[model samples]
Target: MRVALCQIEVGDDPKENLQRMIDALRGAPEADLAVFPEASMVRFGNRLADVAEPLDGPFVTALRKAAREHHTAVIAGVFEPAGDRVHNTVVGIEATGEISGSYRKIHLFDAFSDRESEDVAPGAEPVVLDLAGTHIGVITCYDVRFPELARALVDRGAEILAVPAAWAQGVFKEEHWTTLVRARAIENTTWVIAVDKAPDRSRPPRGAPGGVGRSQLIDPMGTVVADLGPFPAVRVAELDLGVTERVRSILPSLTHRRPELF
Candidate 1:
């Protein structure tokens, strides 16, 4: 299936960010699915309360509308408000304008001294949903650093893993981003599609040290089919699901593993 990754530079204004995503979607070619990066609809530096919105709020509604208009499935990230706290969540909208499913970021970005944990609650579950004929898993930002989470999704029949990350600009970030993403795909033996953000000069950049733009698509064999550089752009790539079975058949690592001893 053909997937489109929309790599956008988010500004301080939520409305402008949302509009830019919509425009990006319009420019993209017809694909079975489209993915956006973490907080693509809003800047990440704003106060948690100010940016938080319900799962069915305007941002998600607009995304659903866009999906229906384009007749394609969409997976985008948003700050989901629940009761007194908020969570970094990814909402999926089907081409039929139906809310498919949502995945909250289990691994919170706590390495930053700013205390992301103090503002957003972490999710406990991994979500896998149907996209066309494939079962896809959803994860966000720091979650990519956790291999166990990706393995769990693969165990649950995920053929492709989607990551929406706001990787900061810092020393060796490009290498880390590429390395870790390929590692996840190679280990899980599934397709990996990571949609990362571009540096937004309008907003104070992420305090953490790391470069922003490094969106990539990796095949089951850990081959990078496309690399969308650190800039505002869109990348489209075709992922063959058949290759997944072929790779696993040749490797046969999943069934050959001896899990009891570690």
Candidate 2:
């Protein structure tokens, strides 16, 4: 199936951010699945509480409408309310505009002196959504650091890994993002679709690091099938599910794992 990665500029306004997301999805090229980066619903700017909303609220409702219009399954991030804090969530909406499932970010961003857990609650479960005939998994930014999460999704019959991220820009950050994305695809023998914010190449945010775009699609053999440079854009690529099976047939790493020892 084909996928569209929407790399948008997530500024500080919740209203503008939501409208941008809608516009991107509506104008997306023909693809079976459309994915957006984390915090695409609204810019948290480190203050998630101020912009968090319910799953069935305006943000998702608008997304569902766009998905129905484009006739493509949509996967994007949203800040779902979780008690006093919020959950960094990536939800799946079918082409029919039905809610498929949601994956709350298990690995919150707690590195680089930023305390994500202080404002966002951690998720307890991993989720997989079936798009068309392909079994796809979902995870947010930091969760991509943990191989176990990807393994669990593959174990749950996921053939593709969808990562919606707002990867922060910093020293060695770009390298880390590319390396980790490719590693996940190689090891799990799954298609990896990672969408992140477009970095301001000329300037950083408030003299602080901002999101690094570099949205990419990796084949099961770890091939960089498509890469959207650090800019606001929409990238579409077709991923064949058979490639995952073919790679697994040669490597068989998933079945060869000694889970009991590790």
Candidate 3:
């Protein structure tokens, strides 16, 4: 299947971000699925409650319309407001304008004294949905660092893993991001498609200068099939799920694992 990864700069305006994503989708031909970055509806790291929207809000409605018009499945992130609490959530929209499922971010980003847990409630479940004949698992931002979440999805019959992140700029996070994504693909023997936000200067002190963009598509063998560098653009790649079977048949790593000892 062909996948489109959007790497765009998010700003303070949620409407502008949503419009940009829609415009980006127009440039690509019909794809089986399209993935956008975490908090695609609003700028990231500006406090969860400030940008939270309800599940039936205009942002989600726009996504559903876009999916139906383009005849493609979409997985995009938005800050979800439920009563008094908010959660970092990714919503899945089918081609028929149906709301398939949603995955709230389980692993909140709390590094470097930034306490996300204060505002956003952690998700209790890992979401896996079927998209165009492929079973895809959905995860947001910091959730990529947790291997158990990815493993659980894989065990539940996920052939592809999608991660949408608004990764901060600091230290060696760029290197770690790529390494961890590739590792997840290799270990699970599944395709990994990670879309990240580009750094913006207008946001705040929390918004640093560099995220490197570095959006990538990794094959089951941990090799990068396609990469979009530190710039704003759309990346498209064709991934064959058959590769998973080929890699597993040769190594048989999953079947040979001794989980009882570990």
Candidate 4:
């Protein structure tokens, strides 16, 4: 399967952000799937509820059209209204312009002195979407820190994991991002397509919370297939699915799980 890691910078304007997404898809190379960063709808530090929309709203509607036009399935983040707070959602759209699945982030980012729950509500379940016969699991930014979530998705027959993150820059944050992404793929024995927002150049270097790009794809054996550096760019690479089976045949870690003991 060919996948595109769209490491584009996210802005506060939903309309502009949507246009940026469309532009990225329009320029991306031929691929089966394209993944965007968390909060692709609008960047953080702004009032979320004011711009939050439903799954069938204009943002997703436009995405459906773009996905159909580009002939590539897309997994991008958006904010959905959930009463008082918004749900940080990742929507999956197929190449046929159908809504494949949606995953709300269960683990909100409440660490590092920032409280995400203050504005965002938590999700209850994990979501897996099928694209060209491959089952891909969806996970948000902070959720990457939790291995249990990845395990649950893998248990549900997910062969690939999609992580869309707007990981903030801080002390050792980049290390954490790279390590966690590789760890999830290595342990789950599944391919991981981890995409993060390119750093917003408008903001002063140490001014506010923002993304540190470093978007990458890791194979089941934890090999880095493609890594897009900290810049606004899109890169596509063909993923050999057979590698998963080959790695599993040697490791067999998933089958060796002693679930009853845990």
For each candidate, the alpha-carbon lDDT, in order, equals: 0.82, 0.84, 0.84, 0.91
lDDT of 1 by residue, 1-262 (tens): 9898888887767888888888877877577788888877666666656777886788888888888898888888888885666888888888776888889888887774546787789898999987656788987888888899999999898889999887876666677788999999998888999988876555454444333777889998999998888678887789898988999999877888788989
lDDT tens readout by residue for model 4, 160-259: 9999999988899999999999999999999999999998777632236689899999999999999998889899988888999999999999999998
Give the clashing pairs for model 3.
none
- Candidate 3 local distance difference test against the native: 0.84
Compute each candidate's TM-score over C-alphas: 0.94, 0.94, 0.95, 0.97
Better of 1 and 2 by lDDT: 2
Using lDDT as the yardstick, the better of models 1 and 4 is 4
Clash numbers, per candidate = 6, 0, 0, 0
User: What lDDT is reached at residue 222 by model 2?
Assistant: 96
lDDT sort, best first: 4, 2, 3, 1
Question: Candidate 2 or 3, higher TM-score?
Answer: 3
TM-score of 2: 0.94
**Per-residue lDDT of 1-262 in model 2, one digit per residue for the tens?**
8888889888767778778877777776488888888888765554677678888888789888878887888888889888889999888899999988888889988899767788889999999997756778987888999999998998998988999898878899999999999999999888999999777444422334467888999999999999998889987788888887788889888788887996
**lDDT tens digits, residue span 166-232, model 3:** 8877788888899889999989888999999876655454434434588999999999998898888
Q: Weakest 10 consecutive residues, lDDT, candidate 1?
A: 202-211
Angstrom error at residue 153, model 1: 0.4
Candidate 1 global TM-score: 0.94
